[model samples]
Target: MPIPATAPARNTKSDTDPDALSVLNHVFGLPGFRGAQEEIVRHVTGGGNCLVLMPTGGGKSLCYQLPSLLRKGCGIVVSPLIALMRDQVAGLLEAGVKAAVLNSTLSYEEASAVEARLLAGDLDLLYVAPERLLTPRCLNLLGRADVALFAIDEAHCVSQWGHDFRPEYIGLSVIAERFPDVPRIALTAPADDLTRKEIVDRLGLNNAPSFVASFDRPNIRYEIVDKQNAQSQLKAFIAERHAGDAGIVYCLSRAKVEDTAAALNKSGVEALPYHAGLDAGTRARNQDRFINEDGIVIVATVAFGMGIDKPDVRFVAHLDLPKSIEAYYQETGRAGRDGKPSSAWMAYGLSDIVQQRRMIDESTGAEAFKRVSIGKLDALVSLAETANCRRSRLLGYFGETPAAAKCGNCDNCLSPPLVRDGKVAAQKLLSCAYRTGQRFGAMHLIDILVGRLTERVTQFRHDKLSVFGIGADLNEKQWRGVIRQLVAMGHLAPDSEAFGALKLTETARGVLKGETEVMLREQVAGARIRSVRTKSRRGDIAPQIAGSGGAANPGLVGALRAWRSGVARTRGVPAYVVLHDATIDGIATSRPTTLAGLRNIPGIGDKKLEHYGDELIALVKAAG
Candidate 1:
C-alpha cells in the first residue's frame, strides 16, 4: 500500500472546472455527486443562495463543503450541535482539508488559534454555533475574513415549531445582512411544509433556490410493536436482527434510559445510558465509546444527541413514542446510513400517546400551539397503529409516494396481519367510552370489556351499565386493541391532562350508535413465539440488487471490505465515507489495472484515483 505524492494545487476560480473535480476527489474521494448533490453544489458555488432538504445520510454535507472549496474564500458554517461540528472538523482534517470549529467545547486558546487561522486565510471551512456567531468578536472576524459563503446546517432549528428548535437560529438572518455578497445555503435533513416555511421566513431564504431530495431511505425497515413486555420484545429484536452491531435505544425519560441500558447490560449486551443529567465528561465518554466500539448500544433520551454521523448503526429502537413523526424519522434515519439494511423498531402503547400529549400540553405554549402539537401526536399514533405499509406511511408524511405496494422491508410486509370486521368491537368500545362519560383510559375500558369488577368501576356504578359486562366476549388484549384502534381511527381522543383519559369525539357517537361501521385488522395471535435458539446473526442487510458488500469479485471484495473495516476501526471513522459501496463495487467489477482505469469508475475522481489507485490495483492483482 503505497501513499501517492500530493498533487499540485488547483485553481478555485470557477464553479465548473477540472480542478473542482480534483478537489472533490481529494477531500471526499467521490467522482460524481449523488441525487441532487451536483446540481445543488453548482448552484451554491455559482454565487447563488439555496435551501436543501435532503434525508439523513443523503450527502447533505458535500453540497456545502464541495461548493465552499470550489469558491474563492472560506465558508462559515453555522451548526447547532457542538458534537456535529467536532465530527465534521475531524473528517475534514483527516481528508487533508484545513477545517476548524469554534464552540463551547473548545478552550479559549483553541478557539483563538482557529480564529488566527481564519484571519490568516489558512482555513477552508469554519464551523460556528449560532450563539457564538452573534458575538461582536465573531462578527468582526467574519467581517474581516474573505468569506465566500455562509451555510446553516440543521436549518430546521430556526422554526419554533420544529422538534429541535434553537432560539439562536432565529437571529441567523443577520448573516445575510452582514455578508450580502456571500451566498447563503440553509440545509436540513427532515422538515415538513410548516418547518420549511418557517425556515424560509425565519432564515430569510426567500430568494434562495430550494433543492429537496427525496425523503425516502428505502433500505430501512420500519416496525412498530405494541408495548406488551416491551423489554423482552426489544431483547428478542436485538438478538435476532442486530446481534453484534452498533445501535441506539431511545427512551422518553432519563429514568427509562438508565433502566433500559442497565437491563441490556445485564442481558450481556454492551449498552450504556446517556442523558443530560449525566456528567458532561461521562456523556462525552459514552458517545465516544459508542462511535469507537463495534456492536455498542447507547440507550439515550431525546436530550442525548442528534445529527450523529455514525454510518453503520444497524438498528434504532424506541422504547416510547417520539413527540412527532419528524423526530421519529430523524431518529430512525440514524440507522443504516451506509445504505445497508437496518431496522427501526418502536414499542408504543396508548399510555405513550397520552404521556407525549400531556408533555406538549403542559408546555408554556398557547392553546393553538398545544392543539397543533396534539394533532402531530395523533399523526404519530396513526402511523404506529396503521395496518398499511410502515415505510409508505412514513415516506408519505415526508411527501414521498413509494413506487411499490409492499417495500418488503417492514414488519407489515414481512408478515401481513389478518383483517377482521371490527365494527361490532368498535361499537362496544365506543359505548363504554360514552357510558363511562369518557373519564377513563384504555385500562378502565379494558376492565369494562372483560367484566373486571374493580373498585373504581363499582364506585363509578358504571359496571352495571349494559355496555360494561356485555363486552366480556373479548379478552383483555383484544379489548386493548379495540381501544387503540378506536383512538387511531379518530372516534376517541386521549385527554392528556387527565392522565390519558378517553374522550369521545363527535365521530364516536356515530360508531357507538351503529351508524358507521369501523373495520380494523385483527392483531396477530401468538406472534410472540420465539425459539430459545437464536437465528444466525448477519451484518446489516444490503439492498437486494447489492448484497451485503455489493461487490462483483466475491473474494477480492471480501478482502477489500476486511481491509476497509480494519482501516475504519483504526481511524475511528465510518467505512462508507472512506470509500462508498458504489466505489468498492466499481473496483471489484472493473478490476482497474492502472490509475487511468481506476479514474474511470463513476465515483472515483482524479484525487482519489491518484491516491488509492495503486494499492487497490495491487490488491486485485494479488487476489487474481
Candidate 2:
C-alpha cells in the first residue's frame, strides 16, 4: 500500500469557530457540556491528542463526536465490537449525525455503500472495528481520504487490567504514525492510574493531554450482602425492589447464567441467558430483545454488558465475585447511566473469594501476571468486606477522595455494620493457620479451629495443636469471615503455589503480637438476608435528591412508552437508541404541546425533533 506523501497540517480554523456549542444545542439538544467536555472538545478541535478517562454515562461520546463534526473531515472511530458500533451509529443517526459502520457482518453491497459514502465525504463519522481498520486495504483508503481525526472508543481495551481487553486494539497506534496531522482521542469508562498510564504508553499518546474525571456514580446505591443461598437472595432482591424493572444479573459461569435465567423465568420474572456458550443467533436475538424491550432481566456472564449501550438498567446484581475492581466498576457502571436512581447490589461469600483466588492461582499466566491478578482480587475483597462507606472506598481505589467521607447512598452509610474489636479472634485464627503449618485453605483451617474432627484433621494430627479447638466459640461462618477479612486486609496472603493455602503475612505478626487490634464485623445469625434494601432501613436518613420532581403520571408515562416502543419497532432499532425512557419521562412529565416546546426537552435532539416531533407533541396533547 502506498502511503500518502507529506500532507498539510490539520486545519485548526474550527478551533475558534463558535458554532460547536451551538451545534451541540441545536442538533443534540443539550444546553451545554458537562465535566471537562468543553475543554476536551476544544483541545481535540485544535488538532491536539487527548486520553479521556471519564466514567460511564459521563458524556465521553460527546468529547469525540462534537470535535468530529466541528472539524473539517469525517472522523474515524475505532471500536472493538459490532454491537457497540451499531448502537453508536443508530444513536448518532437519531441525533442527526451522518454515521456509518464497516464490519465483517456487513454484506458486499453494504460494505460498498459505506465505502462509497466515505469516498464521497458524505459521512460525518465512520465506525469500524480495530481489526477492519488495521487492514492494509482500509489503511490505504484512509491514507487518501480527507480524514478529520481518530476516536478510539473503549480505549481501555489496550490495557490488560481492563475487563474487556482486546488484542486488536494494540495496532491502533498506527493512526498516530500514519495520520500524524489529525488529532487522536482515546476514551474509556473505567481505568485506574496504572491502567491509565498503560493506555497512554501502548496507544502512543504519551504527549496527549489526559483528562481524569471523578469516578463517583452517586446514583447507584452500593450494597454487598454476605452470600447464603445466593439464588433465593437474588430472587427476593428482584421480586421486591425491582419487579418489572429492567436489570442485569451477572454470573461467573455459563451454567449459572442459564440456571439463574431459568429460575427467574419460573418465578415469573422475564429473564434471558447470554454468554459465549449460547448459539450466536440466540445470543444476538436475546441481546436485541434486551436492548429494544423494557423490564426484561438478563442473566449473563461478563460477555453480556460491554456491548449494552442501553441507559435505563435499573440495577446490576452480581451472583459471584468479579475478577477485579475494574471489572466490578465497569459492570456496575452500566446501571443508572441516565443519571437515575439505581442499585449496584451484590451477594458474595467466602467461597466466592476462594474460587476467585483459585482461578488466579491455577492460571497458566506468568508469576508476575498472577501476582497482579491476586492484587486486583484483594482490592475487590476489600470493597466487599469494607465496613466503611462503600462510595468512599470505591472512589479511593480510583485515587479520588470524595468531599464527604460518608456517601449516604450506600448500604454501609445507611445502615452501618456492627463493627467490634476482633483482636482476640484474629490472633486465634492466625494461630490456627500458623500452627497448622499455613498449608491449609480457609475451610480446612476453620474445621481445624472449630474442633471438627474431619479426616484431614485426624490425618494431619492438628486436633492436638494448642490453637486447635480454641476457636470453638465462633461458628464456622464467623471463622470464615475472620479469615476472609484477614486476607482482604492483607493480614493473610494466599499461597499461590499450594492451591490457596493460608499463609501468614508480615501484617499478621502485628496481630499475633497484639501490637495491632483487628476490628471485624460480628457475624449476626440469619439466613443471609438479602441486603437488597427495598425501602429505608432502620436508622437511615432517606437520601435527598435536589430538585426532585413529583412522580410522573403513570398513565402518561405508559402512553409515552407505548409510543417509544412503536417507534423503535418501526425503525428496527432498540427503544433506547430511538429514545431513552428517561427522555420520554421528561416529555410526559412536562406535557409539552408544540414542536418548539418538545425540542426544549433535554433529550430531544435535531433529528428526533424533525422526525418524532409531531408524534410526541400529539401524544402529549392527547394525554391531557
Candidate 3:
C-alpha cells in the first residue's frame, strides 16, 4: 500500500518522463504536480520558456525547482528579497538539494566558495539578488557557468505597472539574449492584464507559454470591513478569531506602523513594527522573530513584503488601503500559504479613497502612469464597495473568469448587506459638487449640502444654494458613505491640482441629469463572524499555546507538533521547513510507526526520512 518511489509528482504526467517522478518522491516527497505545475515543469525541463502566474502558496517554486534538479546544469534564480533567498536556499538544503545564495551578506571567502561550487557544478540551485545578478561580474560569472535555466522569481517586479517594481529587473531581459538556448521562466503571485503584458514585454518572454493558475485561494476568506475605528475592529477581530495565531498587519505609513504595533503590544498582543525607516539590523531582527517565533504579529509597511516563507500565517489584516488590487492581492496572499484556512481582512473608508487619489494625482509620475494608477485604485475601491460577491469581483479584476457569482466565502457572500436606492442622494451630492464650483473636498461639500453653516460655507455663500439642506435626512457618516460609494463607483473624483477639491467626472453628469440610477449597501459596522473552515476548530495549531485555537488536539498531533517545534528551534529553520503542518497532519492521522509508513507519507523524501524516520517511528509507537 506504499506509494511507489517512482510515482509521478502528478497523474497528469501521463506522458511525463519517469525521472521527474523519481526526483519528486526521492528528493521532494510531494505526491505530484499541482494545478499547471506538471505542464510547466515538463515544458521548462524540456527546454521551453514560460511565464507563470501562480498564487502565493500554490507551489510556484516547484515549477522551477524540479527542473533545476532534473536538468544537467545549475539553475539561476534571480530574487529581489534577502529573506526570500535565505528561506528558499535553506528549504532546498533541507531537501538535500545543492542550493546556495550569493548576496551582499556573504564575506569574500564565502562568495568565492559559492562561486567555486557553481563553476564545479556542485550546486543545483543558486539564488541571487536582482541587483547583484545584473552586475557585470555576476553576469560574466554566469556566462561562464552551465546554466540549465533562468528562474525569475517575483517576476512581477519587472513590470513598471506593478506596485513592487524594481529597476534592476529590467536588465534581466539579457538572459534571453545571452543564454538563448537555456530555458527561462518568470513567475509571480499577482499581476493584472496590464502588468502581465509589462512582465512579458520587459522580460522578453514573448513566445513563452503562460501558465496562470487560478488566483482563487478558496482557503482564504476575504473580509473588507467598512473602516470605523479600524484599530478597535482589528483588535476585536484578532481577539475573537485569530488570537495567538501568527499574522501580519499592514499599514500605509511608517508612523502608522509604529503606532499600530505599539497599540497592539499595549493591548497584550505580541506585535512588532517593520518599516523602511527602521535600521537594517532592527528590521532583520523583527522579521526573524516574527518568522521563528510563533503567535507574533508584525505590523509592516509595503517595504516588509514579498514573503519570507512563514507558512502558518493565519491572517493578513490591513489597517490602511494598499495602492492597487495587485498590491492588495500580493499583500493578502501572504496568508494561508500552507493550504489551511486563513483570513484576508481589511478596514477601509472614505478617507482611504481620498488619500489614495491624492497620492496618485500629486505624484510626479507621467500622465499615463497616473491614469493607470487611478484606474487601478478605482477598481480596488469598487471591490470594497460592491454588494455582490467580493471574491468574484476580486478575481475578475485579475481577468479570472468567475465560475460562480457567489463564492460563499467573503463577508458579503455570508451576510449580504441591506441595499437602498441612493439615486436622489447621488443627485443631491453631484448637484452640490457642481453648485459649489467643484472646488472643495468632501468635508466642505458635505458641510454645504448638510447645511452646517460653517465659516467657509458662509464665506462662499454656499448657504444660498438651493441644494443646501437637501441631504439633511442623512447624518454626516451616512452622507460620507454615499460620497465614498459615489467616488468608488466613478461618479466623482478628487481634483488633484486644486489640493483636496471635489471634481465631477463625466459620470457625475449622468447622475445629476437623472440618467443613471444608484444603489448603495449599508455600511458594515464591524468584523463579521469569522468563517472559513480551518484547523483552528480542532485546536490543532501548536496545541500548548493559549487562545491559539479551539479545544484540544486529539493527543498525537499536539505531541508531534511540540517535537517539531523543538527540532525547528534547535535547527534554526522555520518550523514548516522541518516538517510541514500537512506532513504532521499526515503522520498524526496515519499514525505511521514504521519506516515504510513514514516513507509513504508525502513530504518525507529519502533525506528527511533518513534524518527523522526512527524518531517519528518511536514517537508513533509510544503514542500507540
Candidate 4:
C-alpha cells in the first residue's frame, strides 16, 4: 500500500500525530519505529534535549533526521569523520531530503554551495566534522542561521578513558552553550556506565533524557577460537559461510594487516590492506573499493572502522584481541547492520592477552589510567573465557539485562560444554604456578603441570617437585583454558616485574586451599575440527546465508543483487546505500510482482519505489 499523497510534510499536531507516521512509511519506508525511536523522535521534534544509546541498524539517524524536517531550522550534526558525514548526506539527499556536508574533503565550490544552502534555509540537515563545526567562522555562520538542533554522533569519543577518545571532541559542549534555545542530542552504540556518564557530563547534556536500548544483537553470532593454526582456521571459517562475501579482518599491527591480506589473497580471497602507515591516497582508495565493491575484505588495524557507514559487512574476524570490551563491541557491531544474521569470529590465545597487558603496563599514560585499562581488559578476558551464554555476558557489561537466559545464537548455547567441578583442576594449576617460583607464564605453567620436561623445566630441574605432573590428566589446551579463566576471575594476575609472567594473586590462595569452588567449562568433544562450520555450533549460523543449504533462495538473491549492483553503479553509490542484502532477502521471500506489492517491502522507500519499482517488478517476474 502506497502512502497517501495528501499526507502533509510537516505537522504541528500532537506527538502521536499522523504526519510522523506518514513520514515513517513514505520517507524511510518502514512499518513504524522500533524500541524508543518514536519517543526520541517526538521529544527532539518537540524541542527537547535527549541522549540516545541505540544499537547499529536501530535507526539512530532518524531520531535527529525526522526532527530536522519537522522542526524550525536545519539540524547541525557534529560528526567525527568526513567519510561518515559524506555517506549520511548522500543517503539523505537520495531520499529527497536537503542534506549537505561541510568537511575538509569538500572542494571550495562544494563548500560554498553547501554554505549557500545553509544560509538560504534550503537544507534540512548539515553534517560537519567536529573541528570544522567548532571553528570561529562556522560558528559565525551557524549563529546567523535558524538552527533547529545540535546532534553529536559518536558521543563516546569525548570520554578521555574511552578507547576511541578524540581530543577535539572535548570541546563539543560549545554546541549546547552557544545554542541555548535549541535542543541537542548525543549518540553512541556502545558505552559502559562510566563512559555513558562521562559523555553526558562532557557534552553538557546533563538534563537530557537518556534512552538505552538493549545491547544484545541477536542477529550476530559470537564465536571465540583458541589460536591454533590461525591462518588455516581463518581461511576455513571464511570459506565455510562467508565465501565471496564482504567482511573485515582486524589485526593488531600494520605489518600484520599487510601479511594477513597477502595470505588471504594467495588463498583465493580478494583482500586489501588498510592502515595509517600507507599513503593517505592509497588508504582512501582501498577504503572506497571495500565500500563500493562486492566480495572484497579489508585487512586493517584499529585505525579503520570508526566512521564506516557500510551496512552489509558479513563478518568481523579479529586476529588479535582488542584493547577493551568497548573496542571489541564497537568494532564487531559493524557487521550485519541491515539486521540479517552475521558472525563475530575471534581467534584469541595466551599471547594476545600477554601482548595486550604488556602494552597497557608499558604505556605512557598515568598509573590511574593504566589501572582502568587493565580492568577493562580483564572484563574482555572474562567474556572470551566465559562458560555461559556469550550474549548474556556481553550485554551484562553494557548494563543491559539479558534478553534471554540463553540466546541460542552463540557458540556456547549452540554447543554447550559440560561444566565440571574445577576446584581440583584449579588447585593443581595454581599450585604449579606457585611452586615454580610464581614467575612463569601460562605455557611454562601448563608444561610443568602436564609433566612435560622441556628445556625450561629441566634447566630449573623443577620436574622433581611434588606438584609436577599432577595435571597430566588435562591436556595442554584444556589447562590453558583453565589458566586463562583463572586470570580472568582475578585468581591469577599478570606480573609486570616478571615480564608477562603469571603470578598468584590473593584470590588464588582461597582456590588452592579449597575455600573457593571453581567451576570451569570443559572442552567440547572436537573443538579443533579445522573447518568453517566446525562442530555443532556452525549449524546455528548456517541458515542465515544463502547457498548454505538452508531455506534462503540463492538464485533469486543472486539475481536481485545483480540488479541492485547495476542500479548502484548507475548512481555511483555503494550497493548497500541503494538497498541492503537483507532487503533483497525480503524481495526474494515475498516475490512481489507489482509496484503496489513492492511498496509493502520495508526498504523500498518513496524515492526508491519511484525510481526502481518497474525494474524490480520486472526482475521478480522474470526470476519466477
- Candidate order by decreasing TM-score: 4, 3, 2, 1
**lDDT per residue, candidate 4, 133-241, as tens digits?**
8899899999999888899999899998888999999988888788888889999887887888899998888888998888777778888887877778899889887
Tens digit of per-residue lDDT, candidate 3, span 1-624: 122345433232324557676777788887666778888888888888989998999999999988887777889999999999998887888887889999999999999999999999888899999888878999899999989789999998888898898888899988888788988999998688888898888878888799989998877888888787999999988988888899999998999999999999998999999999999999999999888878999999988869578888999999888999999998999998887788999999888988888888779999999999988888899899999989899999888987888887778887788899999999999999998898898888889778899999999899999998888998888888898899888888878688777789988888888889899888555435544544332233232221122332358787888898898888888778888877777787777667987888788988888788999888888877
CA shift of 268, model 4, Å: 1.5
Off by over 4 Å in 2: 1-17, 452-465, 497-500, 523-551
In Å, residue 597's CA in model 3 sits off its true spot by: 1.1
Give the lDDT of residue 250 in candidate 1: 96
The true-versus-predicted C-alpha distance at residue 372 of model 2, in Å, is 2.2
lDDT of 3 at 256: 93
TM accuracy, model 1: 0.89
| Clash counts for all predictions | 2, 0, 4, 0
Once model 1 is optimally superposed onto the true structure by TM-score, how far is the C-alpha of residue 491 displaced, in angstroms?
Answer: 1.8
Report the error of model 3 at residue 162, Å: 1.5
Clash-forming residue pairs, model 4: none
Tens-digit lDDT track of model 1 for 1-624: 011245435234445646555667655655556788878877887888989999888999998888777776788999888878877876676566778898998899999999988888888889999999999999998999988689999998899788888888888989878888889999998788889999988777897778989888866778888788878988988987677888999998899899899999888899989999999999988988887556899999987657688877888999999989999988999988877777788988877876776788779999877887887888888888878788788878888887876676676766677777888888878778878887887888888778899998899887788887888788887777778778778888878557768898888878867788787866576564222122212223453321223347878888777776776777676565456655676678767677877766655554455546787889889888
Of candidate 1, the 10-residue stretch with the lowest lDDT total is 529-538
**How many collisions between residues are there in candidate 2?**
0
